[model samples]
Target: MAGQKGDPVMVDERRFTSFADGETSLELHGLTFENGTDALAVYGNGVFTRDAAGRAALAAVVDVLRRAVAALDEAGPAAQALPDGDGRGDGATSVANPFG
Candidate 1:
């Protein structure tokens, strides 16, 4: 997200990719601000269970996401997300959580 390093940006696309081994490892893919510029990836180690600390961190993150979703309904990606360039604002969302 080098181009998005300055101003606050949003994800335009997101999905998850998993390994064929069915292990507890997965990837989170996100295209930020615009397509073909930069990306954001979050990896989760399924092999490792979440400790108290990890759970706490995840809880905090979820809380913030909740707040942002409530506050930035028209702005933030999570609240009003749509597929890249679709531009319909149809409130459709794609989730690829193989972890679950």
Candidate 2:
């Protein structure tokens, strides 16, 4: 969303997924956004079992790195898919846009 001079615009969130079980279990999520800059701003965190965390963490990092490189050519963190496009694309974000 955009602001209109003084009107508050609906937040154009760079949403991502997360999972958790109470406070002692696990949580995982990632997010990104396009500011008025040359690239997208991104941040994220995840929690998982020590037994499996390594694989999952590596997978997520590898994914974002690959996607960012492909999408932004290492200029800035960036990866987004068209609303209609579907594939293993865009930092592992879900390709099917239910919102669209």
Candidate 3:
């Protein structure tokens, strides 16, 4: 976990993979911005085997995500707003079909 120490990790946008699983009830994706950067998004509940290593790994993932969120917060509201285009070129600001 690169953000374990509360430091923001600069992850490349190209490494993202769209993921969804009904069994685990979880989804992971990368929301790309018009500026060509992407943000990782994890949604819904997650299930993992109960074990010490699993716990530690989950903690690390949480730490990294927290750091990323904190960094975004520090960037202020302008940085938080969605970039232009919305990837559809229809001038839509909100998500049209998130599950698709």
Candidate 4:
């Protein structure tokens, strides 16, 4: 469903929202797995993990996440500052989709 400019919208139980500033903008969305195949679904991108290569791709993503978490831990507090003054920057923005 459509929402006001800044409000989160839900489509098929997946939530969508975005944030922006002068230099950059980010859109947030959810992924759902295919019922029987357990493939990860992405809008305009099709599904993943339905085959061996797809599963490997998903594992790669997980490995990257683990590495990133370790990196952030090594960086400590200085890496977590945000303009919003919220301490949640680490928890919220820590993982990024290496795929896109």
Worst 10 residues of 1 by lDDT: 28-37
lDDT of 4 by residue, 3-64 (tens): 22334333346433322122222122223222111111223342455789778555543443
Winning model by TM-score: 3
lDDT of 3 by residue, 24-85 (tens): 21222222211112433444555544898668656645654666555445556765685655
Candidate 2: misplaced stretches above 4 Å? 1-37, 47-49, 74-100
Error of 2 at 37 (Å): 7.3
List the candidate 3 regions with Cα displacement exceeding 4 Å: 1-6, 9-38, 41-47, 77-100
Clashes of 1: 1
What overall lDDT, based on C-alpha atoms, would model 2 receive against the true structure?
0.35
TM-score of 4: 0.30
Top candidate (lDDT): 3
**Candidate 2 on 25-78: residue-level lDDT in tens?**
112234332222223344455443466766766555445434434433332333
For each candidate in turn, the TM-score is 0.27, 0.30, 0.38, 0.30
Count of clashing residue pairs in every prediction: 1, 0, 0, 0
TM-score of 3: 0.38
Please list the C-alpha lDDT of all candidates, in the order they appear. Answer: 0.33, 0.35, 0.42, 0.36
Q: What TM-score number comes out for model 1? A: 0.27
